[model samples]
Target: MTNLSGLQASRPPEAVYIHIPFCTNKCFYCDFNSYVLKDQPVMDYLRALEQEMELTVRDNPPGVIRSIFVGGGTPTVLKPEEMEYFLKTVRTYFPNWAEDIEFSMEANPGTTDPDKLAVMKAGGVNRVSFGVQAFQNELLSGIGRIHNTDDVYRSLDNARAAGLTNLSIDLMFGLPNQTVDMLGESIKRALALGLPHYSIYSLKVEENTLFHTLFNKNQLPLPTEEDELAMYLLLMSSMEEAGYGQYEISNFAKPGMESRHNITYWRNQDYYGLGAGAHGYARRMRHINVKGVSPYIEATKNGLPRLNAYPVTQEEAMEDFMMVGLRMREGVTGEAFRKQFGRQLEDVFGRPLQKMLSAGLLEHEGGNYRLSRQGILFGNDVFGEFVGVLTEI
Candidate 1:
């Protein structure tokens, strides 16, 4: 067994994440690097992304790409022609899309129409995840979402017409002025969609967002801890009852419909991160690109627009493995950890293991350590005990 830092790999990555930084509008709670689409150099940025793909593949070639996730402010904001051009660039540079590749794109409800969806499908996007945060129009408006419930239905119909059956929708709970009954109604509506997957996330007030401003000003009316917990429990129970498995902390899917691209991330494997403000992990190194639109486009003409790039130390890698791996309902496997790091899991983080197991927050069975039902709520606390225990913070 070896430490996590400098863990060697036998092949290149099979996953690619392309970022499209343009959005119609910024959501109140979003902190993801994105910009308004108006008057932006959309074509110029696409060209830069093409160049980046060429250079990145030349530097470190890819294997058969099993998954490609194009995420952004809203990937569907691209006009049909623009999307065609962008997808062509991807297909040209990364020629080896696996026969069963799961190509996914994030789209807002109003952004995706039949024409744009056709371009996406032709361009290799087989999965569409709509940003339908809530079904209630008032909550949608309060949260800065432009689309109403009608747009949600229209977008789903458009996606179906485009022949994308492997669909997923994103929902949010614990929103401002939202109630338990409101969340339940939203969940009921979402389940009626009969989609294969759903991503339900709780609201987090990150820095530099409108929500943060409201929180700082004491104007935000977030749900109490009890209510938030209740929301989580209700969603979990509802999804399972509806025949979806809670594969990850924030994601649920039908049988064999889990997000492979996301799993590559939780497994701490390598993947290419393309576009402005995108992050990548490869060859024991992690890198983030320049965040600004103009800066990223200009910097790419010279070379890759990397804001920060560094090889992860062994201890840090171990910590990352535990942190992300535990986010899954499957938890971390002792066997897989040994195969990856060449050491026993307990040999590295035995101290935290003893504490979590003793506290009944983590459980071990069949060579895996996963969160118990009680442990799921205290996941952060369990993960924290692993952090800074092996390396300097």
Candidate 2:
């Protein structure tokens, strides 16, 4: 309610993103700021995370934290007691939790067990998302995924037995040695799980990732761009057929099971980003923490572990609104744009909107601008139009 200044808070972030940067093994395609758990100081890093929370709330007091997403190399790698400590810090620092909070943790199938899942449930984690990249053992092994199809079933069973039902799984297409048929099988099995949510993505080779290294040498077997597009089409249709709503780009859910935490990002709202390499947006300021684990811990020892913090310009904010909001199925509303920036949506982005609308890449209905079926395929192009268009407005 109040900050250290003893006055009412100017703005309190209601969403939280905590990063756990340790994993059993680094996936070939993962470039996220994570380290192998082997010789790393796990508990020490967690303690630093708690200290960061204390320092964060001191200046930027929190409102009701409605969603907390613990993401990582693999959050499930944490021991049960470690998880308990982390959640306790979360509760202690941000006590004003919303009644229907959606607390989620990302798990790698082999890393999760009954005891750890039980710790998660007891700590208010109502949702669990497993990285079940594919159902086929060969495909799973072709990539660097250590968990086979069996780990997926066993993990789901343990999660269910722990009384956690709001489950989701992730699938990736365009992987090395993967076929469209393989993808379809993965989708079928995912749907058969009867879980409430699924996230399907196409593999992207980013710098510093093993996939990137292999790609440069033409050693990585990849689907052709056309094939990748086909995979996306299949993913969308399959999810819709399974009665799951494609709420955002790469995410589908059974109606109310949509990820509220992610919606906060798409809506361009504020949230606290805790832990190493986590990014936060609040009070029109976007900041990311130091990327290295030991460096992050050392940085937080004195104060906030900010690698870089900057205030967002009004133009950038408006551009961000369009870029992120358009990812949602409901898309961007004229009303929301007007409310956030006190400018008419058309006034700020008239040229891009007109172009997209004319090209049939976007559709305007009831004064909202949403991507057309075609626009979703060229989402980056559609977003690119709005990127710098606001600067001159």
Candidate 3:
């Protein structure tokens, strides 16, 4: 495989990230490049996505894909027939899938119907992640979610009836007007579902979103830092008590139910990023697609719909390797760093590594460096220590 710059790839990307940037309505907290799916050019966008896939594989042919993650505004928003066509395009271009390939799709609870779930299952989507932000209906409405608690249960029921057992749900903390007890209740209900996987995150107020506007006006009643920390701690303990492993910072799973596609990102491996506002990395190069829907469609017809493309310098790649790899429980290995950069990890990052080790923020054992139990709470700081250190080396 080769990059767009005509350089041979060290290894072909085995993971894929396809974005579908249409939703029923924009969540107040979301800043992702997505539009409300009201009278949009749905079919035309699907064609453009297919074209991107065709052009992408032609330029940099993929190896046997082990994971394909379709994320979105909401991939499940598509009608049943539309979904059939979209999945068909995927099979046509990237057909060499591993027998145990993890084909996952992100869905909103209200968007999934039995017919749509059937089409998704037939299309090879074995894993489905629903955004179930909270169990309380008032909390869900305050966050601008279209679905209520009933939709969450109904969607899971439909997915199960369709014989899709590899299911996951997402939850959020630090929300507006949320209490510690509220979060504890949400976690309790979530555990009761007995799903294989859960992804819980804190709300971050980013620009260009309604939440940001409310925050700037001091109208958003977010939890205090102390409360937020308590919420996080509670979740970790609750998931552990329920026999779910906290595999990543914000993710938990039963054995073997962890998200492999996300591991690709945590390990800083290459993957094909298709559709509007997508980002792809391959052969030390990174590319970001145009964010707007119409602009992406127009650009893909003529050529690749890239907004920006750049090469990653060795220094930056090494920094990225440490930053992303350490997010995993297994952490980064000296062998992987040496293999990729042809230099000892200790030599390149000794200063930062020693500092973190001294501070009890990192633990090194058997040639692997992982965050200490204390460091997991302050992960951002631990990861920040590695940034720009490679450039000095």
Candidate 4:
């Protein structure tokens, strides 16, 4: 295998991610680049998005798109007509989609209606992930989620009715004032839904969020570290017993229902990111677009709307390959590392490998390195061992 170049890729990107930054309201825990949809320039932003897409494909033409994930504050907030135009714009540029393309959109529970879903299905969207964070109404309200449990049922029903049955929902644990029993109840209800995919994430009180403010004031009521660990263990066992495989750290899915777009990311492949505050990686270069909606719109009028763009260093790419690849239950492989960098995995990360393997945190079988049962609980620690370990390629 030849050494990979920062300016070249084995193939063009086959995955796409488009952001929609408007939401009905901001959640207390969300720090993503999003805004409340009040009087914002909706149509103008869509046009700007279209312009960005046009410029993006011109620079790095896509091959056959296998997956398209539309994420955001709430992508389903768009009116039916707006959604039609947005999806049409997407098809206009990268029209060569795989026959089995996984087109997914993120929707808030109450925001998706039958008409909007019909538009989505007609426009080639086959998957919908709803943000049903919790089943308890009080827990939902405390987390600043406007939708209730009833809304979750109705939203799933609507999606199924619209022929978009490949549905997924998100649930959260380690939330403020939440208990083990509460999380268990939520999981029970979620499993009852019989959805093919579920993403259960722990709360990480990130900076600039309301949770962070409360944490600083010592007013936030969060579960203890022990309880959080317990919650994780419980969910893992629960999902496994219910027939969902833990494909990734935070995601579980039935056979063949894993998120292909997300796997494109976890496997450290390239993808196109469009819309305000989007991030893209292609040909070993990474770029982040302007965060503000108005600024992104104006920036797109001129060019690709990037706030910053730079080639990823060879050493950095190797580090990323280890860090992200280890996040999956499948772990990293020596063959993949060699194919990407033309170097054996041990030659690049020998020290970290010996350390983690000695510590019984990583298990090696054949050519692959995966997290052991114990390593699964301390994944971040194992991943940290790979960063900054390479000083030269």
Candidate 3 TM-score versus the reference: 0.97
The runs of at least 3 residues in candidate 2 whose Cα sits more than 4 Å from the true structure, single-residue gaps closed, are 1-9
Q: What is the lDDT of residue 27 in candidate 4?
A: 93
Location of the lowest summed lDDT over 10 successive residues in candidate 2: 1-10
Deviation from native of the Cα of residue 181 in model 1, angstroms? 0.7
**Against the true structure, candidate 1 has what lDDT?**
0.91
lDDT of 2 by residue, 23-130 (tens): 988889999998999999999999999999999999889988899999987999999999999989999999999999999999999888898888899899999999
Clashing pairs in 3: none
lDDT of 4 by residue, 1-393 (tens): 123574347589999999999999989999999999999999999999999999988988889999999999899999999999999999999899999999999999999999999999999999999999999999999988999999999999999998899999999999999999999999999999999999999999999999899999999999999999999999999999999999999999999999999999998999999999999998888999999999999999899999999888878888999999998999999998988888889988988999999999999999999999899999999999988887633
- lDDT string for model 3 (79-172, tens) is 9999999999999999999999999999999899999999999999999999999999999999999899899999999999999999999999
RMSD of 1: 1.7
Greater TM-score among 3 and 4 belongs to 4
- Tell me the TM-score of each prediction against the true structure: 0.97, 0.97, 0.97, 0.98
Tens digits of per-residue lDDT for model 1, 268-295: 8889999999999988779999988889
True-structure lDDT of candidate 3: 0.92
